[model samples]
Target: MPRVVSALAALALLAWSVPSAALQVRLVPPTPRQGDTVMLFVGGTKGARDVEGSLGGQRLAFFPYGAEYAALAGVDLETKPGKVPWRIGLVDGVGTPRKAAGILTIKAAGFPVQRLTLPDGMVNLDPQSEQRAANEAARLRTLYDTVTPERLWRGRFTQPVASRKPGEGFGFRRVINGQPRMPHAGIDYSADRGTPVVASNRGRVALLGEFFFAGRLVALDHGLGLYTLYFHLDGVAVTEGELVERGQTVGTVGTSGRSTGPHLHFAAQLGRARVNPPDLYTLPVRD
Candidate 1:
């Protein structure tokens, strides 16, 4: 079913708190779990404006909401469970700069363990593959470290595939050949070879190329430090620096890199926070 969340329903589901004071701040879901997206709501008389904030020192972007301001925050899947401080500063309608601070108790999340056996050579990268992976990692970091402040993506984020068929769950502890590897950060959707993959939201294509493990890939810069990545593609249709709509075709699914079958690995990032793309789709943000 499509996720259409109402304003009233959004409050109940997020477990947000409203303070009695005229000016107040609340974190949706109150306590954010790993691989989750967070929404910060500021309530005030004449409302909040020019809102600026940060979590763990990463800059946050805020949008004006009538008399108040709100911002989207991403908590990385690799974040350790503990107290995380988020600070906010905003100039009200009166032009007075007001600031507030809060602590988000990063809660623990449970992920399933997945063990799979692949070809020995595939599991172990060769020298050439290692070099490619290293170069790609450095290139990817340069793209992610860039923080775009524009609000390019609007409304609720949609699935890249029309069927919306679910695949492997995010945050899985992946073990290959008895060796534990990095946790699976993105959710997957199984599709046939040459299955078309579309953009999840409006954004400018940042990078498009064949990588070591990602295979044919496309990454979008959705502005405000938000990015969505599509990996293991059979064909890359979009080029770098192209603006794409929410449902624009980006690539095709295939068993392109270090894989056993055809699938699309969709990943999301907010600033430097690598989050679960599927989890972000559940949020109730409007244009």
Candidate 2:
């Protein structure tokens, strides 16, 4: 049986108070078992026609209608054993320009699962470093959950006529100069340096900034703990709070942040947990 967890409990305990205009979110797992397919739902909406979702780096597409949009996405049992973050972005019917979003942090399962141990040097960093990391994680968790337009689920997840081949890997374990570094957390596409990068799905521009490590970073809130990030951009074309469509052009790829070459670093976060992006696309999810 799949274990069920409430997204609200996870978000609330972490101090992510709901935003006044935030979309309502729900996660309905079939049972209280690990590694089961779970359904994520958005309620109290209107004229929605399609949903665009992504976890880690994978993307999902399905049609939506009426007051709610629901999608069944697989949550891992063994990997990402902490709170799970899932993001969903929706668009209403034709010519109705609006989008809505929110986040969901699926509470951990009843039974614990063992995850790989990190080096003491990293985990046992100085108190300040550890605290900073924790704070950042919490902040990111909160931002991932609540940043969205007051009433719009902009974007669509359409099947690429010919799926663009992933130019680089997602979630690849990495070691820099023979020392371990953060695993590659996103998908890389080898497109022309200035080619316009499209919004993977409908979402609001919650964050568009430059960072030491992320270079030119752009975050899209697809609501419900689900967020998509684009990095190493040559230029960002959208402003914060702008509504975007699934295929809207937002930026171009570049060697920004800590990158060595021009490529798009596409990543997704569900609450705080980052899963395999490819899994989001290949997993057998239903609308």
Candidate 3:
């Protein structure tokens, strides 16, 4: 009887020593390239009440996905190719907070150079135009800094325009008017002027304005610090703060901005990272 009692005691001790649950983390792509959008999933969190995380110093906004929690994060176009640290925190059912850490491997992507010749006035802005562009740029930075606490998009994202032509020039280094300029942060879609442009997914119209460089622009807030921008529009169809649905027309394409021809400039931002807009379509978001 004593031997049996000892065996039971040992078994009980083993059970007591092991944790009931452990925190788990996963990145959908496992390995991502610069300018790619990543989907982060956390499991083994059966009793977790809340979850939060950060990647490369940028905050991640988490939302419940079935039995797990997930967030969308972006690797900027200029992010150096290497390992980036990521950390996660979880609040359990009884309010006990736990933490987990890992590294994300970012692969290098080659971006080709693009050269164009434009009017000198457009390439080199006048003093007044320079100041106006600077002011508008600052406003855009402020808008991207705000994070919406919930996920407002559903299912997969679609192309913003119906043109059969594929997007081009994302992350392209541009030499315009014989002067080097910032890398192109968005993709261009060649289409006829007044071609309908629709929202890639459900979102709220965040801003609509005419600017020195972007021309008529419409910015959409898709929550969780994710935004989509439509630039160089011939016309705007929605007002700021209006809730928009997937595939709804937000504007029409045109060469309103500093452009050689009629085309749509579609861009995306996750937090402050300028990610490729097409990457949004590959995410595993549910309807």
Which prediction has the highest lDDT against the true structure?
Answer: 3
- Which is the better candidate, 2 or 3, if ranked by TM-score? 3
* Candidate 2 structure quality by residue, lDDT tens digits, 36-143: 345556764465545566643434433343456665454543354444445666554432334444343444444422233434554346777667656654656678
In model 2, the runs with Cα more than 4 Å from the true position are 1-139, 147-165, 278-287
Q: lDDT (CA) for every model shown?
A: 0.82, 0.58, 0.91
- Candidate 1 on 9-125: residue-level lDDT in tens? 777756534332445887887998988899888778364456788887677887765556777888888899999998988776656677888788988788789998988877788
- What local lDDT score does residue 156 receive in model 2, on the 0 to 100 scale? 36
Ranking 1 against 3 by TM-score, winner: 3
The sequence of per-residue lDDT tens digits that candidate 3 reaches over residues 230-279 is 99999999999999999999999988878889999999999889999999
RMSD for each model, in Å, please?
11.5, 15.2, 2.7
Instruction: List candidate 3 segments past 4 Å from native.
Output: 1-17
**TM-score per candidate, in order?**
0.87, 0.53, 0.93
Error of 2 at 117 (Å): 23
Clashes of 3: 0
Question: Cα RMSD for candidate 3?
Answer: 2.7
